[model samples]
Target chain A: MSLAASQAAFQAWLQQADDAGIAPTLADPRGLSVYQNNYRVSLMACLSEAFPHTLAWLGAEAFEGAAARHVDAHPPRSFTLDAYPQGFVETLRAIW
Target chain B: MPSPHFGPHFGLGLRKPHYADFLGGDVAVDFVPVDFVPVDFVPVDFVEVISENFMVPGGRPRDILRRVRADYPVALHGVSLSVGSASGLDADYLRALRALVDDVEPAFVSDHLCWTRLGAFQSHDLLPLPYTAEALALVCAHVDAAQMALGRQMLIENPSSYVSFAEDEMTEWEFLGELVARTGCGLLLDVNNIHVSAHNHSFDPAAYLAAIPFDAVRQIHLAGHTARTIEGREMLIDTHDQPVPDPVWRLFAEAITRAPHAWTMIERDDNIPELAELLAELDIARDIAHQAAADHQVPA
Candidate 1:
């Protein structure tokens, strides 16, 4: 699969509430779901790491929700996930 | 020197919640407790380490350092050193880092060889730099200056990159060897990172391990990584959100045999489980090391 196609597939996988039709009998959807949650969790952590002042400004719950949504929309183009939420301040500005 | 608290000298990332427990409880971790002492917290171990978080001035950073430095060796793990960038080092930032190093009297200080900025734009991520001669020269100069300013050696850690640079020269390990030669700095080899970078870049993991000087390695970092096959091209992402994976465990086993006395630690930056959970993982690592040592006695 091309990079774009696979990226879209993962995007679709992430968008699905439970990844309904994926990951057959070998691994449960629960494992995939947990992995999905962690993908978001790690991105939020990067948000907190990069924008601690933003986190302090928005508070944890709201900041987390916004960060997850932001990542969902902007998916990282770079290989490194270190700055997944590097544009968060601007994203927060656009949203709030 | 063997850490008084821990017998074997391997530790896990001391997250915030467990800080109070670690400081209050009598038990200590590893021979050298490679842990972080966050801003606005009391001192815990014989050493108070910082994550370059509170390595600033006139704010909670300095205040926290003042309180923690009363006890413990202060080692700084910085995320912004960008020792692999072609744009050259940030002198101002380095100067501040040097000042902080002096104040802490840290046992050692380190940063990733990944560039976090392009020009004036700072992404705040430990982004990977191209493995080229230009990149190597820029990083070596910074390492040399950082060592001179701090009046001590600086250890450079490998970065986990998702994509390979279009322009490159030599392997990452070769660049590391060259840097050591040019600057006389040490290495904080991240085992999981070796696995991650090798997976992403499609290189021989064993070959990468063999290239670096084992003696120069002062520390080892083991963290979790996530894998997702994006359109058939698999990508392994380093996400320090869970327990160390099994593959990393195997790789870590190989590492300890080579760098036997190297100080190692598990890094969990998010979704941090209970201290018991981390300790349990640490217990596994300890057990593996013991078994490995025991096997050597049988004469392989």
Candidate 2:
């Protein structure tokens, strides 16, 4: 595959590892799970970082559930994780 | 007036919790409880702000940054440069970043060497790149484009990764060295990242440090990570949510020995402690750098 194609495949796999499955070209597909987990955990942590007060108020389990739903609905579009939770307060209110 | 070049300085990431302290305004000191008593102030040689946070047209963030810039030299650190993207550099992102640079007049600008964006989707993570001649050429071209657009040199940071590419023809250090040689970009060597990647990939952190061109290093980052046991193997994840660990501090001392003049900063994005606590950590960095300078016979 071309470089662009390879990068696209890699990103897709990271975003939806179980569904997309690992890249067919990868030598060790199991390692992709580590990257996939890191990707989700980091993004979730970014949301938690941005909405600390909300997390504290909602507690861990509820906050994690809300954050997961929010992330599923709105995967980050910007390069900065700081901006990932721009409308999260409203999202939390709507969901709650 | 142009900002004074404040030689090599120690700084901390100007986090929101400490915004009022630096910006000099009314903030609820009781808002967050801490072990250390809340103090009105602490002095830092410089401050590093996430470039994207202030890339807005006009708002409180810009206002606060302008006030802080008046007092402290700010360094613009970005996460979205995505220099390794195969689709090419984002023109619109470059334009906004350049405008912010002109507005802020930061002491320097830096971003990670890894790519974060792919086509219209941004992963928001510093994804690793394969070390190959083709990748090197592409990154150099993108760096040149970024520098030309911004009218200033940029610093590329090393990223922590969980996996290595089988197609890589060279080590990441070699890729960075070649990149600096080709594009005149500097390095923002993150000691914690070096330690994390070294552990995850089973490479010598010292060897990685030795391979880098010391003179090209313009800044250093120190941060903490989360450790986990995966498949009965210990993996260190660059979480940046806590204080710098002992091993990272050791690597940082070694890093200072090599690049004595590079500005160093502590980064904490989550689980942030009191500003005073971070300042204490920065003090450790200062002491270590001072000792390393003496040992290496480099004037501090």
Candidate 3:
């Protein structure tokens, strides 16, 4: 794959767990899990940090469910994590 | 553009947990603990702040950075430059960073060599790039554009990556050296990153260190990483959540010997401890630098 195609595939795999898309270009398929874990954990942490009060109100289990759903649906567009929290209000409303 | 060579300096990343300590003199903020008292100034040469955090128009983030700038020389480190992107540089991002650079008059401005944004999808994580000639040329062009926009030399840091592409035509060190040669940008050698990538990819850390262009190295980052097993194979993740391990410290000692005058700092983003605790870690860097200075002298 070209650099652009490989990068796009890697981004898709990271955001969507579409491992099949990136597995071909990967030097080691096992390391793909590490990147996936990093993407999910960092995004979850971003949401948890952004909505402390909402997390408190919704409780950990429910808040995590919502955050995970948001993460699955919304592939972050902003380069900064600070801008990621802006969409969580809609997620909270849609779920709760 | 001038060099980012700011004499032998040691510092720490200005994290949220220690905001009170950085903003000393009885300046009470809502986030600070009520029992927190004003302490003496932190004994360090400089402090680095994440550029994206303070890229806003007006807020407490900007206020905190402004106040911190008054106390110590600040280094504007960014994560969103995405220089390795094949598409091009982001004009808005560069403009905001240039504004921050103008306001801070930072000791050095730096970002990673990896791309974080691709097209409309921003990964927010440092994604690896295949070290091919095409990617190298693209990165060099972006670095040149960034330096031109900022009107100062910029430093590019090596990334700790988990994956390497099969099509890579060069090593990360060679790519970085060529980047410096082509664009005249300095380097921020994160010793921990070299250790992590070396361990993950089964490369000799010493070899990578030896291949580095030490004269272009203006700053160094020391961070802790976590070790984990993936598919029953041990891998090191650049988690930045623990104290500087022994091996990373050893590598740092070797790095300081080669690039003695580079600015050194420790990064702890998660599981952040007390200011004094990190201060102790910074002291470790000081000791290493002191010993390296005695052991090997870089001519002025």
Candidate 4:
């Protein structure tokens, strides 16, 4: 596959790891889980970092649930994690 | 390209918890411990802020940054340049960053060397790149284009990586050396990232530091990481949520011996302690850099 095609496939696998599965093109598929976990955890942590008060108020389990739903609904569009929390207040309000 | 100017100094990541301390306010924030004293003045040499946080059209972020900028030189550390993307640079993002640079006139602008965006989607993570000749060429081109767009030389940071590619032809340090040779961009050598990537990929951290072209490094970042056991193997994740670990501080001491003039900062993104705590860490960096300079016989 071409470089562009490889990147596209890898990204697809990253975004939808459970459904798409690791691309056969990668070196070792076992390590893919690390990247996948980091992807979700880091983004979720970004929201938690931005809305610490909300997280403290809602508690970990509830905040995690809200953040997971928010992540599912809104995959980050911008390159910075700061942009990931743009509509989080509304998302949390709706969920609550 | 004109070399980015960053005089030798130590600073802290200007986090929100310490905003009132830096920007001046009576707003009661709960994240900061009550026992912690919020001083009226922050005497750091510079304040590094996430460039994206201030990219908004107009808001309190900008106002706080403006007030803080007046007190100390602000360095714009971006996470979104995505210079290693195979697709291309984002035009709108570049435009917005350029406008911000114009407005803030930061001491320097820097971002990770890894790509965060692919096609229309942004992963919001510093994804690793294959260290091949083709990837090098593409990254150099993108870095050049980004510098052109911003009308200033940019610093590409070494990202903490979790995996290595089979198609790799060279080490990351070699890629960074070639990139600097090609694009004339500076390096934001994150000591913590070097330690993290080295441990994750099984490389010598000192070797990584020795391989770096010291002259090209304009700034250094020190941060904390989380150690996890994955598949019975120890993995150091660059969490940046706590104080700078001892091992990373040792690496920073070694790094500053080579790049003595680079400005250094402690980056604490999560579980941010009081401004005094970060400043104290910055003081440690100041002491280490001072001792390293003396050991290397470089006049401070």
Which structure among the candidates has the greatest TM-score?
Answer: 3
The digit string of per-residue lDDT tens for model 3 on A42-61 reads 89999999889988988999
Docking class of 4: medium
**Best to worst by lDDT, what's the order?**
3, 2, 4, 1
Please name the candidate that would achieve the greatest lDDT relative to the true structure.
Answer: 3
As a whole number from 0 to 100, the lDDT of residue A51 in candidate 2 is 80
Worst 10 residues of 4 chain B by lDDT: B24-33
TM-score of 1: 0.69
Poorest stretch of ten by lDDT in candidate 1 chain B: B24-33
Instruction: List ranges where model 4 is wrong by over 4 Å.
Output: A18-30, A45-70, A80-96, B1-7, B26-38
Candidate 1 Cα errors over 4 Å, as ranges:
A1-96, B1-8, B25-50, B58-72, B296-300
Q: Which of the CAPRI classes, incorrect, acceptable, medium or high, describes model 2?
A: medium
- Model 3 C-alpha lDDT per residue in residues B63-152, reported as the tens digit of each score: 888988888999999999999886678899999999999888998999999988888888888888889999998899999999999998
lDDT of 4 at A81: 70
* Clash pairs for candidate 2: none
lDDT of 1 at B180: 85
Comparing candidate 2 with candidate 4, which one achieves the higher TM-score?
Answer: 4
Candidate 1 displacement at residue B125 in angstroms: 1.3
Look at candidate 2 and tell me the lDDT of residue B207: 95
Compared with the true structure, all predictions reach lDDT values of: 0.65, 0.84, 0.88, 0.83
| Residue A67, candidate 2: C-alpha displacement in angstroms | 4.3
The docking quality of candidate 2, as DockQ, is 0.50
- Give the TM-score of chain A, superposed on the true chain A, for all candidates in the order listed: 0.73, 0.82, 0.91, 0.84
In the order shown, the candidates' Cα RMSDs to the true structure are 9.8, 3.5, 1.6, 3.0
lDDT of 1 by residue, B1-300 (tens): 232223335665555556444444322343113563333433222332445565556674465555445544455788766665445566777778877876766666888887654434344455445566766777888788778877878889888876554456678999999998888888888888899878877788889888988767777787898887754567777778778888889888877776666667778877887666776787777777677667665221
